[model samples]
Target: MLHIRVITPASRTDEVLRIAADSPAVVNVLKLPGAAFDPEGDLVEFDVAREGANAVLADLKALGLKDTGGISVEQLDLSISTAAEAAEHAAPGDPEDAVVWEELSARTAAEARMTWSYFAFLALAVQIAAIGALLDQPILIVGAMVLGPDFGPVAAMCFGVLQRNVRLIGAAARTLAAGFAVAIAITLACAAVSRLIGWIEPTMLDDRPLTSFIIHPDRWSFVVAVLAGVAGILSMTARKSSALVGVFISVTTVPAAGNIAVAIALAHWNEVGASLVQLGVNLAGMIVAGIATLFIQRLMWSRLGRHDIAPHSPEVAAGQPTSGRVSG
Candidate 1:
């Protein structure tokens, strides 16, 4: 279930109330007229089934509340109302399978930003992976995978292609390129320091048994990446974020990049070549798999009449703001 709060202008309060009253998915409707101070309007609240939230939000947007006032939505952690249960039972489709495109796009787009913290996390993950590679520790490699922040830009690019948003694609590309570059450079420096301190022995790279996974690229690596990509995107759309941890460790993205940095520092040209291939294969597989999964999800939802997202305009495709678009 989801809780919705809408501040409606005086002229449209009745329309908003009517919309809420008519919707079978809405329950516990409350109206407080002349209560809002910010655009100075009525405050309307309701509980709606998660399966039907996108429809209600679309209706609210059609009424222009997003422009005249504002609409806020949050998941209801606890709803004790029998009416809410009836609403959920009455609403068609499973809430777990629902994909709110506007929310997902906005979220992934935000995650694609090239902030200082983003770089720090990526670089730190790579450095950690370097240590894992040198020590041939699977646990540390998995830890680096979990700490890596590279998935955001890849997901953003997939979202951009689905929405045909050129600016999102551009921003994600630049952030990804810069992120990998910075992470690799930082990992290289860390590898040099480790060598200077005699922390990384030459035999670590030569007789790497447990760590060979990071530098080896093959069909299995691509297959795992594809599976992880699908699982990752599904976890995001379904709001089952705990599943992302599995996705994080299922592929060797960060570890491969880290191996590349360490191998270059140690002058292991063959290992460097293999690690580069591994990195490229994993990244390509994830991006392609993500795009395919999201496309299929949108198609399936639209066919079921469960998703009613508006078609993107030219401005929206360019990543410019649209009038009164509501997202949370």
Candidate 2:
């Protein structure tokens, strides 16, 4: 279930009430007239089944409430009302399978921001990966993979393509390119310092099977990248974050970049080239696979009638019948 809060202008209060009345999935409706001081409007709140939330939100958006006032939705973890239960039962489709595009877009937008903290995490993860590669420690490599934040922009790129938002796509691309570039450069500097201290030597990087795995690109690397991409997209769409952690550990993007940094410090140009190939291959595979997975999932949902509750035309929603009380 989801809790919806809307601030409606005095002129549109009737329309808001009518829309709420028409939505069978909404329950526990409340209205407070002239309750918004800043917006100078009435406040309307209700609970709706998760399966029907997207439709309600879309309708609210079409009403221009989000611009004139505000519309906010919060997940309801616990709702014990009989009305809530009835609303959930009346709403069609499985809540778990529902893809709230607005929510997903908002989440990805936040994730795609290239803040200082983002670079810090990415650079720190790469540094850890560099040490792991030098010592042939699989555990530290896996740890770095978990700490990396590359999936945010990657997922945003896929979302931007689906929504045809060029700005979002560009922003996500910039965040990714800049984040990785800085991380790699910083790791390279760290590698130089480590080499000076004798902590990272050419001998540690040569003929070590584990380190070789980080530098070498093969068919299996692409395969794993594709698999990780699928899992990552699914986890995001389904809001299953635990599965996303597994996806992170399954890909070699960070470790390969770390290997490149170390190889450059050690003057292993051949290893550097191979590691670059590995990084490029995994990134390409993941993005392509993520785009494909999201497309298919959206198509499947649309075909299943799960996506049929988009906002009605303005005229249509305006003509919708009202069935509930509107105080004030």
- Each model's lDDT comes to 0.83, 0.82
- In candidate 2, list every pair of residues with a backbone clash: none
6-93, model 2: which lDDT tens digit per residue?
9999898887887778777889999999999988899999998877666667667767786799988898889999998888778766
Q: Model 1: per-residue lDDT, tens digit, 1-328?
A: 8889999998999988877776788899999999999999999999987766766777677676767999888888899989888887776677788776657867888988899999999899988998888888888999999998888899999988888888898999899889989999989988888888987766788876887987779999999999999998999889987898889888788998899899988888898889989988988999999999999987786566553463353543343322331121
Local error of candidate 1 at residue 205 (angstroms):
0.6
- Top candidate, metric TM-score: 2
Clashes of each: 0, 0
Instruction: Give the clashing residue pairs of candidate 1, or none.
Output: none
**lDDT at 295, model 2:** 84
How good is model 1 by TM-score? 0.91
| TM-score of each model, in listed order | 0.91, 0.91
Estimate the overall C-alpha local distance difference test score of candidate 1. 0.83
